[model samples]
Target chain A: MSGASDRVPLPYLREAAVALRDTQQRRNLATATTTIRAKRAAVTAEMPDWEALRVAGAAIKAHTLANLGHYLERLEERVMAAGGHVHWARGAREANDLVRGLVRGTGAREVIKVKSMTTDEIGLNRALAEDGVRAIETDLAELIVQLAGEAPSHILVPAIHKNRAEIRTLFLRAFGIAPSDLSDDPAELAGAARRYLRERFLATGVAVSGANFAVAETGSVCVVESEGNGRMCTTLPHTLISVMGIEKVLPRWRDLEVFLQLLPRSSTAERMNPYTSFWTGVHDGDGPRAFHLVLLDNGRSRTLSDDVGRETLRCIRCSACLNVCPVYERVGGHAYGSVYPGPIGAILNPQLRDVERDEALPYASTLCGACFEVCPVAIDIPRILVELRHRTVERKRERSPLPYGSAEDAAMVGAAKVFARWSRYEAAQRLGRLGQGPFVRDGAIRSLPGPLAGWSAVRDLRALPRQTFREWWRARGAGGGATPGEHEGEARDG
Target chain B: MAESARNAVLAAIERATHQVRDADPAAAHDALTRGYRQRGGASLPECLERLEERLEDYGVRVTRTTADGLPAAVAAWVAERGVQRWVVPPGVPEVWLSSVRGVEAIADDAGPRELDGADAVVTSCAVAVAETGSIVLDAGPGQGRRAATLVPDVHLCVVPASLVVELVPEAVAGLADAVTGGRPLTWISGPSATSDIELVRVAGVHGPRTLAVLLVEDA
Candidate 1:
């Protein structure tokens, strides 16, 4: 919420490069990503019209975001009309404060939470802790992260980096148990988490969550989860506080048709998620007596303003992009160093914060376009990344103005002068081909001695071939008795 | 302290309303309704089409039938699956089951253990969706409580054609009076599924593994 603990302006590119070299992280990521990718492909392939549906889904979100302010107001009014309360927050601090105030009002000293990335983004748990209220994570992976006092690495699976043995250690140390007694089997671990959370769920009077989708027509908030913990959190508590992003609204309950299909397959590669709980306002005596909806803006409006980047808002937080990303797989989620960790985070975090502050993030992608291909909402992520890179470059240029006679400025001016003419361009290319002799080592430039050292640090650059394209063209023309323009025409025809 | 906190939130909402008034409330409301209609909600047939597309996308099988043949079809499905015990929602029409016999039918009010032990659960939907192939289950007489449909391994929901709505707005509008003035509502799209860290697809995580929807035509 505060700028003080916002992501440190550390050298993320350098750190990510180092992390990418870590064999264990790479292995874990490759295995996990490949498996998820295959599963998603298999599931999505079953639908003959998946592509058409994806296009429709993207168009709907784009249209909604274009008229976001109107929809948000409609959502607020509808919720109120349904006897539900709506709270608007400009930023994370306001959102967190609103939630804490609601919890405090309930006279609740502790609260149980369903897995909500929005809460993590706003640092809600930490804020609640500061106010002397304990917030317990009910989701298995989230509980492991909470016990270890770490930020979530992956959006879907928070403690994804930690293996079963590591989880056993965390549970043993945090809850006072023996690791030897805890089995690595998922069922056993899940049973243990269930036992651990049941007491908190039953005892807690207030529950906090993030909504997967909020229907504006009925003012009903829907939460879809694989575990039944969300159902318990939503239904069992005396009061329910749902912190949702402003972009999460669907106009009517029927709009859920597209997303209900898009989300499950893209997220967990499932036909349908296990538990989808929808609640409107409050129930007399069935579930929560009091309900509050905190609509969080927190940089969303800023993201919405950018025509190139606004498509990122359409994300359902499915994490399909993350699962297919080669870059995300190697570095894991922690390397992104944000609550949103993966391909989506890479482009999103930098834009949400000033590009100058989180500058290293935009360059963290390989531009393979896997994320774009699999994205349910059709967010052209690679295009956005390139645009962000241009923005970053412009910001850098603005920050450090080049003097007229400086070497860097002179070189830029000189290049502009030379690039204006075909003769000069051909001369430079010829010289570059001739100049490659010394740097060429067995046809590859493995090391660079100067300013280019950073790029050569991790990857080898290919050596320039002996003949320039112009020279080759000239030689081929001599043999064929054809001019370069003719050769271009022939190439185009072929 | 509790009263003060409530007052503070109420005050905040009041203040927010006065702080920003860029758009006309009526215009904003109309634009939203129109936009929502354009996005996914429209006619019952459109909604049903969307539901069928979504259901097939999610790997759920859907069948269309009339109310008279409903019980016979379900019985055949039960026989095919070798199911011995089937759970039926309390409000399902007597005519729908008039032709079926031999299988044990547990009422919707059956305990969680009883529902869990049944091979299948069949109930009439509070509302049927054509767009998402989803069935809405309010705590109505036939639909039963949330647990009955959820705890069973196989869930077969019957939706009469007349109950289907094209868009979420229609669905919400259809249920508005009931939800605001009547009872608790539940909207279900498909069967339950999950994918673990290994990305292994697992069915029946916390709810039914197989969800079969029979869209019954009105007589």
Candidate 2:
């Protein structure tokens, strides 16, 4: 998706360290995400059944994914019946090739694009460039990022990292508009883009898009957006190709009711976005005359295999999780080093890629639960992150060179021995208490030696208590008649 | 090769979700607990009033008129904007433009060139949602094509009382026909907006900047 590699090159800590130094990105992310967070809270609170809607959204996605193959077949049949063609893509290469061939078949050198993350995930634009076909991003943010030669920092607002002045400067250079002719006003910059792309929208014969949701019941593809760019790309082109991730398909038309309400409120924090387009197949005289839907598997089936992490597929890409994530706020999206960034990215990136390549992503969250709280589909992202972390460690241990594995594995093995029995654990605790004299300061162990030193460096590990929990429990109120409040008081005192 | 890819993908999905692959997808879907509200509690009058309020909240200039006064309202909007060469798609009432003298009314088939050159496009909506203040065009009758409403500088939409639905669910229930019928639809919540710049709400973009709605109440 980044065009150079399928996997993030460096670990998350390395990427995050670089991103943390960019104060502009951090500030912009904080402000944008905070604003959206408040707005989403407001709009969602107004609905009495907001939680129920979330439940329904989760259920719908789970059901669809459970029968993903069945729904996909139905979608293909319905799309073909409605005068559209459906193609299957096993991976990024296949999906990109399909889109490239479709655009080439139109005999067009340049194609217009709606802001599609799935297309970005497959690197379709670059793939098309190999054949000398140009794909122009029509979304305002996307166009800005394209001109600046950058990746989209935010899923919803791709140019969230760019401010008005940067945009104005970029447009002035790219469109060759004189300095006096353009202003840093967001509206003025948008107007400049409109003027620049209006002709392109009308003239471009091929358009590429990503589906927000594809209804299997009616074979309709839904795209929800604020600007009319999505409308332009889907409507004005003679031939439209929509690349959809397998999980995007929903079981029925009525399911849209849940998503339409959930997405806008959770995505941009509005009751509804400015524009949403739904088209099925090819209309005779309106919109696209020819339509192609490429169903891209692209490791999605692999993601579905993990029962704990499968809820990651339920994500609608609303960016609610990103906006609410504290880690995402400070480090911004770039640190995740993938098209997806934030808590959802933390879990999704690893699951959708080779786990070893993205092992660091799963550990990139504070587990504050804000992302899970705001997730429109109830993705349980925190739970998924924990599960992925476990897998990452397990995978790493399996691939270690030593038969006995690494030091971390040795420590875990030793801990398992001691923890397996209460007597050994008690003996170890007594040994830890005896050895803590040098490290304990102000009742907290601020530092430790060797491998434990790294874990204690960033956090305070409490000194081994003078008495253990079992000892305390035996000493305080041995009778079974003790009330919970009494026990809380005694525990606090102890 | 394509069929093989399709078969492989299907097999992979079946293998991944083997727990539910053999179960009836329809049954699994139907068995889902749809706890969300199906019907909005608003009455018809409330729906109309809310629709006007919400549409106006989106910066759309809204006006109300009876079915009889709709043409006069349209004439007022046209005169107010000084719109010339308006593209009136098929199924728009001829009387709406009969009162407005100066503007040249173009037909539905005016090429993209003509549509881009036109000052405005006016059409009646297929349905309107009260909760979100959104108007849906199903490329039906007066709605013409998606380009008519999109390419023009200004879009004036007519929302009839009977066509208003109170919530998103209610609107989708009726629009399923259009989806299966292969009528591509556009739901315009307001004139174009972009939150891409620092996620700040900025109005007026590539789509029509000036959007006005005429809500006609039944007499």
Candidate 3:
């Protein structure tokens, strides 16, 4: 069985910083993100009431989460009444064990898998492998990642890190395609994947899936996707096991109206996705004779306890935040070392794994608020990032010997104290100018001697002004703020 | 083992969120302001227009037919597409396949391999969404097993005008009973497609690569 809690590798910053130098990775990310960004914008613009849909989505999820116990009970009853089995898993190990037992009951040595983040989060493939069952990824991007033996870097596009040429090369090595016969064309590569996985789909007897949404009232599970692989995995198999995070449950089937509009536009930027498969339990001589729904909690209950962090549960896994994240565009997803990455990962990983384990994550963002802008559920990601950062600092403060904390923490505390009072701020401004005398060159501080040096290394930093904003406001007659910079500078003095 | 885990998680959620399970769903739902439109408020002709445009946008081929002409339309399209064999759902109207000649018509009772061997699968839709250009099958009478629509390389979904709705919510509301009754539902919009490779869309992935929708007029 897989471990219950997923712990991210702690070198997020170092690896991401290193990856920033790979011009090719940067180019791949920039091109992919830009294309998705433009498409999302165009589709969003087409719907005049997009914001209304977002608000409705957030409200529905909030209501579902609030009454989760009732819905869970109701869903269990309905699914069981419909001749399907329901297994509740407190964490990943329980989920994996349940799935393994079910698959074993079917006597299947291999299974086809739909693209699911929850499966990745729980390391389900590894657990299946331990049981001598091979789980093949059918999504083209996921297939590429599986062949390359790399963790998914992006949620929507798992192989977004690789360009056409790299994928062509990987396909040549992995799929046994002759090098000269393969080209760096996307359509050609996709055709090769379709040909390769089609046989597996026809052969596999068991399918393991992760749900996009599970309607409580209907006892139904929904898997939305662009590729038909999800359909193949869900339909062809005789036995189907769906492992879903508890937070994925929705109160009603009609609630899909709001999500359907929000998810496709927010995720793939399509008016509608290619296929959305929804199955309620097992059918008589139809698809999947046996159906199993595993409700997985993992660390979600812990996350739900935090008022500020709980909004992470509202996420639909659309990855709109990732496409717009500046940091994600530069460093890519591998650096996060979590199934989830980008702006959502920065806040979500820390909460799922807790602040102490993934402390470096909350600091991964510049708090640009682009993620919040595009979030379909109106998650307020920037606010959560700040809250997680505060939680991280608090934990550090409690762990450290000094009341204030480390050198960087001490500097922040000192700055806060000075900023709390106007006289202290002016005094500090004067002190900063005087202290920068040694480092100042050509009206800028090109580099610093100590901890602050890291900031200036990547970009030129302008020297501290000779006069503070308070001084400038005073000279501009304080209230006379008609000039352009006068009002903005005066606002800063507040 | 399962019950205890289920209870534990439920208890944890209740304790952490401080929310009881007894909240009245109707009251909560009533309080919610679903600021979005329930329907596109388009005329039938307008909706059909929008549906055709949206379907075409997704690379689906949209064909029109009268109540009495559906079989001929289906047959002609199958012939034009060079389909030598096709499968029909058990509940599909026999009259619709009457004009289909020179091609073997198989039953839905076939296995996935047999279905996959067919050139195309034809079935009727439970509902159609105009705004999103979607056809939903709840595995009802005319619609066969989910595999019938999925396994074959081509899907020809016959949507009657009576089943067409102007918005997704309208179509979803119509399926509420089926959804609650535990029927398998599949929503198809165009053919199977993916934009995973460099964010460039390529159609005909894993599901039926070609989707042809026959919009039949209401009797």
User: All models: lDDT?
Assistant: 0.71, 0.86, 0.86
lDDT of 3 by residue, A299-393 (tens): 89888886665688899999999999998999999888889999998888888876455787877888989999999999999999888888777
lDDT value for model 1: 0.71
lDDT for each residue of candidate 2 in A1-494, tens digit (9 for 90 to 100): 22433444467777777788899888888889889889999999999889999999998888888888889999999999999999999999998888877877888999999999998887887798899888899999999988887888889988898888888888999999999998887777888998899889888888999999999988899999988889888888889999999999998988998999999999999999999999989888777889999999999998898676468999899999888888888888777878899998898888887746578888888888999899999988888888888887788778888788766888889999999999999999889878887887766788789978756754677666676667667666576454456644543343
Report RMSD for candidate 1. Answer: 7.8
Worst lDDT run of 10 residues, candidate 3 chain B, spans B17-26
Better of 2 and 3 by DockQ: 2
Off by over 4 Å in 3: A1-10, A416-494, B19-22
Which numbered prediction scores highest in DockQ against the true structure?
A: 2
Better model by lDDT, 1 or 3? Answer: 3
Candidates 1 and 3, the one with greater DockQ: 3
**Backbone atom clashes (below 3 Å) for every candidate:** 13, 0, 0
Better of 1 and 3 by TM-score: 3
Positional deviation of residue A2's Cα in model 1 after best superposition, in angstroms = 17
